[model samples]
Target: MEKLRIVFMGTPDFAVGILDTIYNSQFEIAAVITAPDKPAGRGQKVSVSAVKTYALEKNLPILQPTNLKNEEFLAELASYNANLQIVVAFRMLPEVVWKMPKLGTFNLHASLLPNYRGAAPINWAIINGETETGVTTFFIDDKIDTGAMILNKKIAIDSNENVGQLHDKLMHLGSETVIETLELIEKGNVTTTIQTENSELKTAYKLNKDNCKIDWTKSGIEIYNQIRGLCPYPAAWTYIKDGENEWNVKIYDSKYIEEAHTYSIGTIISGKKEMKIAVANGFIQIESLQFPGKNKMQIHELLNGTQISSEAFVK
Candidate 1:
């Protein structure tokens, strides 16, 4: 197979892994398209995207497009004369950009196609308490994640796996799968499989602050999964009322205890060194947590330094 001229499009740490793989391979990466720098963190300092940083380190040409459909951006992209385009963890592209390449454009999705085919697949799969999920490579189409799949690799979701753990697993798995798909395309031996038709499809829409709030009304296992799914970033939060002030507590590591508890649902049960909350069927022990204006710490540490009110309840 000839050394193919490729253009890579991505913006997050997840996409950086695949770009690294391509950079170290025989394929020629003509240009990289990533999101423009945005203000972030305390003091709102300008921050470059992961892909842009990697591209700069490798001395590869870079394009930070505010809009993919802009004529100037499209004209510059077409100048790369790339045979194919690879997208991972990037914004949706218009057809004018996706169809610019000779081999068309393909995306590396974090979850298996036809399922979890939306924005936040890695988090949603864990949030819904799924036992298995996988990554897929597919040709881009008009609808999001609705294209025919070229390759897929399944991975088991451990019972105690959280979004952070699962995200790492899929990232490495996707890297390998993407390389394999690119090789198949180069050899003109790739086979495409259509996504299964279904009336009921699982959607992984973008998570918002309201969706991250823990709902104790759900079953013990459901609440447990929710806590784990949102841990580490955009963490699962709940308001705790302490007399006059309401404090926001972000819950991280947790486990559901099957043993019955006398406390009412939503009640905050605490020990001298640990904290637990009652759910519908059981109790969830909080392993790590953070209160408003506080750093993340283990329950034992928080219990030692802070006094929690006895009447406080998760709102």
Candidate 2:
């Protein structure tokens, strides 16, 4: 077998560890392709992608292609002479780019394939109250995450785990999986299982403001899952109202009490030091949260700054 030359593609912190592990391995990283830098925050300063930052520290060749199908970009990419391309936390690839490599393009996805096949897999897995979700490596196909599976490793989702915590676990696990996958591909010992489509399968749709809003009508368990699943990023939100005054609140951490409750859903129960929201058959005790124009703080701190009225409710 010939030596493998790899082109790694990814953005964000999730992909950084995998790239680092790959770099330390015996295989060659011919180049890295990440998203183009753009202005971010109030400063409008150009922001470098995490992958690019790592690549620069290692002095690995980098490509920031705004258009994957652009002729100039393709020519530059082809110059790398990489036989295999590894994608992690990257955008969908064009066939022209993915098909360029002879050993083929394989991706490290955050969820077990054929299940949470979309952008926000880790978030949806927990939000749907799934107790088990795992990482999978597969050869990229024409569709998203519908590729033939090369390898997978399952891990249990703790009852209290948030998406941020789950993400770290999967990332570390994915690093191990990626190295194993590289060895298999390099040694020509790879095998794959075709993914089957099932209508019953739950899809991981992209998170948006509309979908992230807290729907108090659901069971307390569901609302709890939703809050934890989106914690620390694109958080699950609701409006806390005291009479006509309303504040948009983002819930980060919460615990559920399953005792029977006669109060209407979305009703706020608050004392000087704590806050809980009424839901079907229970109350959700908020642990940490944030309001618009404010940083995340504990529920007690939220109460300390502003006293919620007895008539206050969340909707």
Query: Which whole-number lDDT from 0 to 100 does residue 208 have in model 2?
Result: 98
Residue 298 accuracy (lDDT) in model 2: 93
Each model's C-alpha lDDT?
Answer: 0.90, 0.93
For all candidates, the clash counts are: 0, 0
| lDDT of each residue in 271-313, candidate 2, tens digit only | 9888888888899999998888988899888788888888999
For lDDT, the strongest prediction is: 2
Model 1 misplacement above 4 A:
none
> Residue 39 in model 2: shift from native, Å?
1.3
* Pairs that collide, model 2: none
Candidate 2 deviant stretches above 4 angstroms: none
Clashing pairs in 1: none
